[model samples]
Target: MTALGELQRLRASRGGPPRKRENKAAFLFLLPWFAGLLLITAGPIAVSLVLGFTDYNLIQPPEFNGLDNFNRMLSDERLHSALRVTFTYVLVSVPLQLACALGLALLLDRGLRGLSFYRSAFYLPSLLGSSVAIAVLWQQIFGAEGMVNQVLGLIGVQGRGWISDPSTALSTLIVLNVWTFGAPMVIFLAGLRQIPVMYYEAAAVDGANRWTQFRKITVPLLSPIIFFNLVLQVIHAFQSFTQAFVVSGGSGGPSDSTLFYTLYLYQRGFNNFDMGYASALAWLLLVIIAGFTAVNFWAAKRWVFYDD
Candidate 1:
């Protein structure tokens, strides 16, 4: 047979001009991601949506109901308490975190010796903030018998159990959030470096002092980055979980002082097996985050500057 005739024979045997083979390779490359998105992400999301309208224990088959879970949330006193606690946490932590970050970034912008080491050292806490070991360390540090009270004892200050005291427990978490300001600090450092040094030199020629230069040049230029960091830190603070969970022993104890929304949602869904109510709670959290982000974006129009 001629070469062309052989090719035709191969295609005939394969039942086409190899369209299936080309499709097979395409599907093979996409298989793992497809499976992961569907099974790992989309499946759970769809299940949660369905569960929001049902009564599910996760141990028993789900019993379908309409809007009951959401309606129950309206009068749930614990949900209100949790919302208040979470709002307090977000409002306190986000601004403090950003302020600390901006201050550190300003200090680092001075171009000092051993700069890289200092940068890495400062960022280390942020890298470790979400780790269980750090959470445990925080627990010990704020515990009644821990180092905080030890120093207080030496000075005759008589420090209370910071993590166990209802009034102080949430404050400890807020401090922890602020301590992890390193990530935003690094971002602000990058943003500061991107500002043209010529701007400062020109301001100097115009007889502007350091304070005047910063106000006229750096602050306006850095405002957008500040806004970006603010929005992200706000969202993260609102959804804070690990620190509160570990510190509060997952009970939101010391009179529910540390009962964050996510912690309460976990307790209702997984711990109590009330999946329907938990799903509704999760949706409510989504709405809260979305609303806050929208407000920030709307507010940014007035203040956040884009030099371009």
Candidate 2:
């Protein structure tokens, strides 16, 4: 008999093929994941979408009021200020942070001694950057009688309250964001190691300088990594909440200068008890993030390179 006919005969001799039993077991194993998806993630998202169209305080039943929250956003001066602050933070900090990461990665890639220690030390900031403790520490460092002013005092210069100043409060948060460069630095270091040394050697033999080799070989090969970091950092910067919230004391205060979109959403939802408006704001932030990510992907085609 042919192999297929023999197999069919064996299966018929048995009750049936064992594939059904295996499939059942696999489904059983995946049940918890499916349950969590429906209960934890998907359920909240569905409810939030419904809540966005209604006006419901925590105390009252939802009253359907389509587009009012959105319309209010158009004329909300504070919301506009928050948008501007957020955009500025993303634009200014992401590039600076990436630059710092790339510089440090380059330094570390040169076969430095105590490489592990240095890498760990540098990466620690990223782990702690968003923590409330770090934010509070940052506040102390920039306060009127803080370390910054103390140092300036020794230098015969005056220093003001950096975090408390409306003009500079946002800048302090931006500096905090930039300080969390360790994560990207590690990624860049990995990307640097992946580059084949032969290409650099070939350029060197051709009398190319370090800058030339970097411009022609390193950049082209590393563009993909750079783009990856850029997209991730931009998204991360937009979603940043803890640093701003903790530093601003959950008020986004000093004339709303440090008001992040997420902070405003939190104020509306929890502090003000305006759940419906907060849901709308949450969806809006999602749209904004999605739009920026889409733009990054679209723009990446012109800059990002690959081996193939």
Candidate 3:
């Protein structure tokens, strides 16, 4: 029989089209989200790509600048600083956040008492840490005569302005980012629960120590989750804006020490009214993030384990 005839016969033998009742219901439920995705998400991206090639500020008509904005990045000193700060934050914060997340996940996996409460308490920071109010609170806590300094006074160790010093401002933000490890920790906990109890029991029968079992079994089994979180957290860290913006009072000050890439893009687009340059910067960020994510996927082949 011909391929199409055979496929039709096979389908005829099993069933016709699926019932539309449940499918129609699901589509109805999803309509709002789909509409939002098209209007809120996809629409802006199309406009921004066109903006990247223009010289429009809010006051003037958009004049095509071709590759001018992209080319200017080659010699832009502030762009370089923004890139360096962003890279440092991503490199330092992501690994530290993952490590803290993994550690907390492992702890919670031991089936401790009040597990829900502990998990909720740990995850609370991730829920609220990125809010403007939280960032403002962080600024106050890290100020020279703030809570940190007051605690230091108790120990007779004088404290410096953690968020005001050029050298230390970014570090404080890194800590803030790291403190929100609860999200990944929750994901890791879920991954841990999925592991078969029989695997650990089998390892125990072979006289494996806790360390050995964790190293050989838990680590291998959790590699896929680790890879997932790594990619997500890296992109998240690189795009961080609100914390740095609030901490530095939207100036990225203390010598531009907290100049995250997104903050710099905002400074160019809105503050300086250089919308074209800001749009270019936004696309540049997408390219950088895409490159890193591609590398991560390529690297995953070596370590990420799947059961097929």
Candidate 4:
């Protein structure tokens, strides 16, 4: 028989096409994921969108308020402060963190002894950095009579409460953010390993120095990795709440110097029971992060290099 006739005979013998059975199996495997997307993610997102336009204090029915919550953001001084602090934190910490990561990645790429140990040790911070315990430990470390002050005193220098000073509190938080550079460092190391050693050898044959090789070969090749890390780190920084909440004692205090945008949203939602306004703030943050990510993607056309 012809192939089509044989296939039809096989299908008839099986009572249906095999594809139908395969599709049903695939769909069955994916059903749980689809359910989760609808119930856990899409459902709450849709509800939050609706809540953004209503006044709901969790104690009463939600009353539609139109654009009042968004309008209120225009004159909300604390909200503005939160925006400024968040922007400052993202801007200062990301570059410093990436620089530190890249530097360490370069050092580790040289086939150092016990490289796995070093990588694991470096990666531990990124894993624990956002945890409540780490934030609490950070708070203690920067306290007036904490380890930092004790070390300073050993040098005959008096150390004030770093987390209590409005001018310095944010800086301390920025330092903490930068210290979690392990994630990007691991990514950078992987990217570095993928680079062909022949490129460096070729550059050396042309009398190029180490800086020239790095500038001409390493950077262009690794630009995509750098851009990837940048986008992820920026998004992560924007959503940061645990560290600021814990370090600031859940208040964003010290004159609101460390008031991250998400922390303020938490304060409004749970603390003041202003769920409506908090929902609006959450949407606004969504817009802000989307805008920044879009900008980065648009800008990437000029810099990010693909092997293809």
* Root-mean-square deviation of every model: 11.1, 8.9, 6.8, 8.6
Candidate scoring better on TM-score of 1 and 2: 2
Instruction: Summarize candidate 4's per-residue lDDT along 108-209 as a digit string, tens digits.
Output: 996799999999999899998988998899899999988999999999999999999999999888988898999999999988988999999998999999
Ranking by TM-score: 4, 2, 3, 1
Model 1: residue 254 alpha-carbon error in angstroms: 1.1
Clashing pairs in 4: none
The sequence of per-residue lDDT tens digits that candidate 3 reaches over residues 1-308 is 22323543575697669765687888899999888887898777778899999998988899998999988999999899999999999999999999999999998896789899989999999999889999999999999988999999999999999999999999999999999999999989988998999999999999999999999999999988898889889989998999999999999988989999999999998889998889889889989999998899789879988664
* Candidate 1 runs further than 4 Å off: 1-35
Computed on alpha carbons, the lDDT of every model, listed in order, comes to: 0.87, 0.89, 0.90, 0.90
167-213 per-residue lDDT for model 1 (tens digits): 99999988999889999999899889889999999999999999998
Please give the TM-score that candidate 1 achieves against the real structure: 0.86
Pitting candidate 1 against candidate 4, the one with the higher TM-score is: 4
Model 4 bad stretches (over 4 Å): 1-23
TM-score of each: 0.86, 0.90, 0.88, 0.90
Q: How far does residue 127 in candidate 4 sit from its true spot (Å)?
A: 1.8
- CA shift at 239, candidate 4, in angstroms? 1.3
Which of the predicted structures, 1 or 2, would earn the higher lDDT when compared with the native?
A: 2
